[model samples]
Target: MSILINIEDLLSGSIVEGTRMEFKKGWNPVPIMRSICAFANDFENEGSGYIIVGVDEVDGKPIRPFEGFNPTNLERVEKELVGYCNLIQPSYFPRLSLEAVDGKHVLVIWCPAGANRPYKVPDDVTAKHKSYNYRIRFRSNSIIPNDEQTTELIQLTAKIPFDDRVNTFASVTDLSKSLMREHLQETNSKLYEESEEMPLEELAEKMNLSQGAKEHLFPKNVGLLMFSRKSQEYFKGAVIELVEFPNGLENPYTEKQFEGTIQKQLIDVLAYIKTNVIKTKVIKYTDREKSDRFFNYPYDAIEEAIANAVFHRNYELQDPIEIRILPEAIEIISYNGADPSLKQTDFDKGRVRARRYRNRRIGEFLKELRLTEGRGTGIPTIVKSLADNGSPVPIFDANEPERLHFIVEIPIHPKFIEQGNNQVSDQVSDQVSDQVISIIKYCSSPKSRQEILNFLGLKNHSMNFKRNVQPLIEGGYIDYTIKENLKDRNQKYVATDFGKSVLIKIE
Candidate 1:
């Protein structure tokens, strides 16, 4: 039993004798009932507090321990307390306990704050007449409620807010016309011009925004998202934040904040990624043949991820969407508000039908943008792009009623050159070596220098490779045949049987 008070501690303080902490002698039901109510009410305001019994008072304060109450009488006290609470607030019952300290009996009643507020005494005329009403104040002081305070108490207990409160500050004028125009063009270019002069509200209605209406209350959907300028303002909890960590982990070295519309945020976030996250590197296959490359994550896959976040996130949740970039993987998190429709089994079996978006309107708009394709293709696209590039499949995990998190692990491929006796040496640098290997290992059977460079994720550094690859041919590791049809004198490097043998030995 928790010792809320000791005899010595009680003696040292000004404790009211008959409120929660003090008990008057005899079967004083009125004071005890009021104490229960006060204790229950206080629990709502100040978390938890205890009511103690069997303590004596001097000057309205407990100075010495009163003789313990009879153990046999505890059953009566328990029954009465339960009856009182049930008659008062049927939904909430305070937990009660009895204990003995220094041969004296004390009653400890614990009340929990009600989850549904404004609990009232049950509506039985006879019970209401018999039950007591009292308020608990600081220390043990008990006060008979005045009319004003009693009415205030009733008001405090009964107040509950409705769920669908509209934002009066947000109007149709805040929407972006240009963004809506773009979406219209993508969804049906023929109707784009026809709908140009339509009222924003009419457009919102025509797009089936009220399709899932319940009790005449329709939530703002995807069409509103594509057009709304102050969408975040209208939807108080909707915001997307992209954070970039220097080491790609919990502690971020730098962070950028983006708000307003999801489309604008997406564009800004992608630009930030291009500028800060991706890097280029050169991998040398031999002393003569060096390949220029970039990181292994496909640009298309990343775009799909961003589009997914914007379209699928639960805007009803007050949590912001997050993108975390780590050294080994990238994580995208959207507020899901309970388990997602898609499961690990669905992903494993390549069953796209199981996935459902929380925001259908936003998803359709993204599809119109060509940011995503027909039903359930985005995740597969992400998986295939990574796999085709020799990268690992992205992992997806759903957090119930809160978030859906996706982790894409960018695979690093290593270039191997075989000597003999199964001894392989990596002939690539760490920077872009993995990307270079992926290109060499997966490209069509044999490719031109330009073709290999492009396939190896080297589209950005075409000029650098053109100037630097000659040394590899001179080193005897790579051989190229001269063909008049090939405008460049050095047209292609068909890795010789010796080169393949070397690669095999290294592997």
Candidate 2:
């Protein structure tokens, strides 16, 4: 945020504090200091926050026609704020500037994020101040969190990723050397040229799967996912539960749990989707010599959706990733939700989905395995692939309070039910007789009885129209607009899906 807020802009009533902006009536040391502390200790990755003094707020909205800070108190307030910082345990120096709106002024303090994090708010400005109270901004308010919330904030402030933490109960031997070696070779990186010769602990450290201990190394969560032969032993929710519902309800026709190293699990799940979930069909148009091919849903799109769930899901959560295949659609639901740093409107506005991965180590490994294109390219790929395959765009729901699971719903391909039943089959040897082909190829519009006969250079619409146009209509290449009322004066023949497919093939 800049060191200035335009009075005109503020008066325009368009400014919403959202997650970062705060409005204060005056430089009340207690509340203002708390705001500064919260901004400095911000852990939800909201880069930096701004605190504006002199603008009065009620019910989270800034009211109009109110006078801002008195121009006289600006310097005095700055000095007092600077003095308060000195009395605090750790110092926080903010960039202070006086901005004028309609000749009335307000102090804008820019509290940027500092490297020395988890700053505490002093109990008072007393010389013997000793309290180490912490505060954080949640939405528009600064809150002193409860014990559990405090712990989560501390972890977020330390930047301790869930995937990198050491699983103390699991030994380094839990990691499988054979699986690590296979992954290294599959990725084919020069960094792993001597991977086979490296000790298990060293290899695990190299892949960020294990961290060295004072005596014995321990496997990290990411390491367990990659090299551990029994990852499910520690992480009970690590498995992906795949279920196919025949009636689209709780009754499962087939249920399977894929539990193993994540890489292996992803491969197994993808193979299962291709074999069981996806249905391929051969389509022939009219009496064409060749046919067309498509599937119930694009396999590449499915891979993107499933990979996104596994790679970015919050593995610390107790729930497993779910792949539910129903008659109408395939849904991939991941445990936990999206980045809390962003607002729901941000996702609705088509903002960038990922600025940081929930599991950076796992995501990096997937990228190395060519399972994903990192740097926030996965969602766009899924969208484009679905659209190109003539399917509706996939729906993604993140941070829904009720469900609290990231869901990707891909509708079943339209052709899934209508495949072989399509009017034209690929293998029809005489789908359209030669005489009928001559009639359809020459007409742009739907030709009537006499019009078709004239185009075929026949004298009458009697038997000539029957021999030529009748075959085209009955063979499924063409159809009359009013089939039941063919005797109507406006009745005319038009090409069907079978005919259009054939026309393109012949071209």
Per-model TM against the reference = 0.44, 0.53
lDDT of 1 by residue, 301-327 (tens): 777777776766666677777877665
Look at candidate 2 and tell me the lDDT of residue 487: 86
Cα-based lDDT for every prediction:
0.50, 0.68
Query: Considering every candidate listed, which one attains the maximal lDDT?
Result: 2
**Candidate 2 per-residue lDDT over residues 1-507, each given as its tens digit:** 123233344333333224566788876787777778887875554444667787877766666555588768867877888888775447876767566565677777767554356777775654384566888877677888789878876776557457766788889988888777766655443334566678887777655566656487788888887778888888888889999898987764788898887876787777666544666555677866677755567778899888888887888777999998888889999977776654556545444556444676576567555676545556777777777777777777875565477788888767664545656644323223344456567544677777777777765524335434654665577788787887898888777777777766654
- Residue pairs in collision within model 2: 176-227, 209-223, 284-425, 284-426
Instruction: Estimate candidate 1's RMSD in Å.
Output: 24.9
Q: After superposing candidate 2, which stretches have Cα over 4 Å from the reference?
A: 1-157, 191-193, 213-216, 250-252, 287-292, 342-351, 418-423, 427-507
* Clash count, one per candidate: 19, 4
Name the best candidate (by TM-score): 2
